[model samples]
Target: MAEFDVVVLGGGPAGVHAALAAASAGLNVALFDENASAGGQVYRAPLEGMRAASNADQQAGDVLRRELTASTVTTFFAHSVWAVTGDYRIDATGPNGPVHCTARALIVASGTTERVVPFEGWTTPGVIGLAAATILLKSQGVLPGRSTLVAGCGPLLAAVAAKTLEGGGKVEAIADLAGTADWARTLPAMLARPGLLRQGVDWWRTINRARTPRYGRHTIIRVEPADERLRATLAPCDAAGRPISGQRTTVLADCIAVGHGLTPATEITRLLRAKHRYSRAAGGWIAVADQDGRTSRPLLYVAGDGAGIAGAAAAATHGALAGLACALDLGAANPVRLTRGIGPARSAHRHAARFGHAMANLIALRPGHVESITPETIVCRCEDVTRAEIEAACDAGARDINQLKAWTRCGMGPCQGRTCGDVAGELLMRRMGTASRETVGSFSARTPLRPVTVEALTGNFTYDEIPIPKAAPL
Candidate 1:
C-alpha cells in the first residue's frame, strides 16, 4: 500500500548510490536489501557481535551507510522481495510479515550470481562457491577451512586466496583457469582504476609471498572426500579449459571454494520482457540499455552487475548515473545539478568499468569446460539432475531450457534455474551446434520469484480470496 517515486532492488553499492542520487534530486525513494546492512558481498558487513575493522573498503561502506542514514530514503533492510509485478507492485516478506510497495520507476541493481560448471564433486558437502567462502571469511570472521584450496577464475581467486591467508587458513593451492599471461593482458585495463588495481596487486602478492602453488591454466578436474578432508585432482587445461592429458596432481584439503566469475542476474529484466541480447563470453543475457542505464522499458533501469559484470567501483558510478538519468527522464532533477553530475559520473563509470569488464571477460566459460562434464556429474544440485539427463533431454528433442526442464527437470529446482540454467543452456547449445544462447532460449522466470512460505504469502486472505493458478496445458 506504500508508494514512492523510485524503488531500488538490492542494497549493494549500485543500489545505495542510486537511492542517494534519486533522493538528492528531491524524489521519494525506498531501497530494499536482503542483508541486515547496506553493504553487499564486496563490502559485506560483518555479522553482529563481530568487531568492525577499519579498512579502505570498510571505510567506503561506512561512508555510504552514514549517507543513507542521513538521506530521506526509506530503507527496507532484510526484506526478501519475492515478486515485482508489471505495474510496479513490489511484494516482499519483511521481518514482521508481508510488505508491499509501488513505484513510478524501478531500478534493479540486484547484482550477480556465481557461475558454476558441473564437475565430479560440485555437489559434495564441503565444496562451496566463492560467494559462500566470502561470507565465511568477510562477514563471519570464520576460516573457510583449516586447509582450503581456492579454485576458480577472475579476480576472486587472488582475493579469496589472500583473504584465506589473512584469516589464518592454510591455502593448499590455487587452481586458476587463466594463466599469468591472461592476467598480464587484463592488467592494462585494471590500471585505469589504480586504487582497485592496487588491491588486486596486494592480493596477488600475499598469495605469492605465502608460496601457494598457483596452478596456472589449470582446473580442478575431479574432487572427492578423503577421510575427513577432500582430495582434488588438478589438471593442466588447454586454452579453452579442456583437461590436457599430461600431468595431473592430487591435493588434499579440508575445503574447496570454486566458481567461474559471475553471471549478471537478469531475471528481473527478462521477467519485465525488456529487449535483451545474448553474449555468453561477455555475460549471458543482459538487458539492452543505453550508457546511462535506461533499459528498453522507459520506467525500468538496470545497474551494477545486473546489467553486466562490473566490479563495485563501476557499479557505484553506474548506479549514480542511472539514478541521475532516471531523475532527468522523470523531470525530477534540477537542470543545474544534473548537468553538473552526469559528465563526471559517466567518465568515472567508464574508467572503473574497463577493469571490471576485463575481469568478467577473462572468466568467460570456455567451450571445453562444460563438455568435460562426466555423465554422472550432477548439474542441478537442488534436483540431483545429472549431465546425462540433460543430454537425454536433448536427444529426446528438448530444444530450449524450458523444454529441457520439462523433460529432465533440470531448471525446476528451488533456485529456479539461477545456478544451473547457464550450464544447462550451454550443454543444449553445444548439442544443437549453436553458438548463441538465444538459440536455446533462457528459462521463463516464474513469479513469487524466490521461495516464499505459504504462511508469509497467504496472510489474512480467506480461502476464496487466495488465488489459485491454472494448471499448465499438456
Candidate 2:
C-alpha cells in the first residue's frame, strides 16, 4: 500500500531524469530498478579490474548519479517491477516480502535488449554478443578472451572495439556491411549536430589510435571452432553474391562479439495496454506516444529505449519531458512551463530517429541468419530448450510467441522470457509468415517481481506505503 506522487520504474538514464524532474517540482517520488546499482547498458559500471579501462566520454551515467542521489527521489535498488495495476499499483519483492505500492502517475524507462543473431558455433564457450562483452567488462572487469573479432553492424561495434582495446584485449578487426561510401553518406547527418559530431570524431580517433583493422562491406559467412577457440571466415560480397577472394580473409581469434542492433524493451508498456506501432527507424515495435511521452493510457508514460532504441541522451531528454507531463497530468504544478519542455524533447527525438533509421538499415541482417540453427544449440539457456525443439513446435502450429512458449517451453524458465522471448518470436515469425505486430505478447510475469527469500515474504516487513519525508533539493 505504499504510495507516492510518482513512481518511475527503471534506474537508467530515463528513469533517473524522470524522477529528478518530478521531485524537483516538489512531488514525492520513488524510483525502482532491478540492478543493484544505477547506470544502464550505455553507462555500465566499471568492473573491479576494469575501472581504469572504461571509455571516459561514454560514461555519462557517472554525472547523472550524483544528481539523482541529491534529489528528493527515494530509490529502491534490486527491486523488480512485477506488474502495473490500475492507477499505477506496483507489486515488488523487498527484503521483507511481496509488497504492493501505488503511485499517482507512472513513468516507464525500461531500456533495450540486444537483437541476438543465431549462427553456427554461436553457443560456444567464448562467443557472445557485442553488448554482452561490454557488460562483462563493465560489471566484472573481464574480457571473454585476449583477442576477439567484432562482427555486426552499428556504432556499438566501434564502441566495443574501443573498450576491448582499453581493457588490454586485442581487437583483430571490425567487419561491417556499411562501407566507406555508406558511412560518408551518414557523415552529413552526424556533422549537422556539433555535439553528436564531436562524439563521433572522438570515437573515430580511438579506433585510429588502436591500429585495429576495420573492414567495411565485410560480412561473416561462417564461424568454425579450432582447439576450443573460434575461427571466423569473412569476405567482401559483391551485388551479385560473389565473394571477392582478394578481400576475403580468415581471422583466428579467441572470441567473436556479434549482434545486429538493439530492440526496444516494450513488454511493460504493452502490459499497460499501450498502443504500439512498427517503426523501422526505431529498430522494431515501439509504444506509440505523443510529443510529451504520453502513451495511449493517460496515467502512463514511457521514455528512453523502452519507447524505442534511442540512445541515452535522447532518453534523458524524453525523461525530462515525461516527468513534466506526468506532473501536469497529476495537477502538481504549472502546466504551461511543463509543456514547454516538449519543444527540445521533440527535436532531440527527431535527430535520434534519423540516426537510428540509418543505422538500422545499414546493419539489417538477412532472414537466413537463423538458418544455421541446429538441434543441439540451446535457444533458452535458462530453460535448456533447443533450437530443434522450437522448430518442431513451429511446425506443429505454435506460430505465436505465447503458443511457442507453451508448446516448447522456450520462455518458461526462471528468467521468464525477457532475454530470449523476442528471439524466439522473431524466429517463429520468419518461419511461419506471422507478422511481428500480432506475435508480441505480454511477458509471463508473476507476483513479487524480485526474488525474495521465503522468510522475508512470511515476515511483517512488507512495505505498503512509500515513506516520503521532508523535501530535499533536487
Find the candidate with the highest lDDT and give its number.
Answer: 1
lDDT of each: 0.88, 0.74
Find the candidate with the highest TM-score and give its number: 1
User: What 10-residue stretch in candidate 1 is worst by lDDT?
Assistant: 457-466
**Residue lDDT tens for model 1, 107-150:** 99999889878799878889999889988888888888999999
lDDT for position 95 in model 1: 79
Model 2 segments beyond 4 Å from truth? Answer: 47-59, 94-100, 221-225, 235-249, 363-378, 384-388, 434-474
lDDT of 2 by residue, 1-474 (tens): 788989999888888988888887779999998777678877765543444443454457677777887888989877767667767888777654566789888899988778665555666677788888878767777776899999877787887787677778998888875677767777766666667667667767877898889887676766888886788888785422234566568888998998867778776777677887765457666788987789998778998878877667678777887888888888877767766866776777677656555655555434444454556777687787877788788888775677878887787776567667656665677677765545554344443333456665465544766466899879
Model 1: clashing residue pairs? Answer: none
CA RMSD, predictions in order: 4.2, 7.1
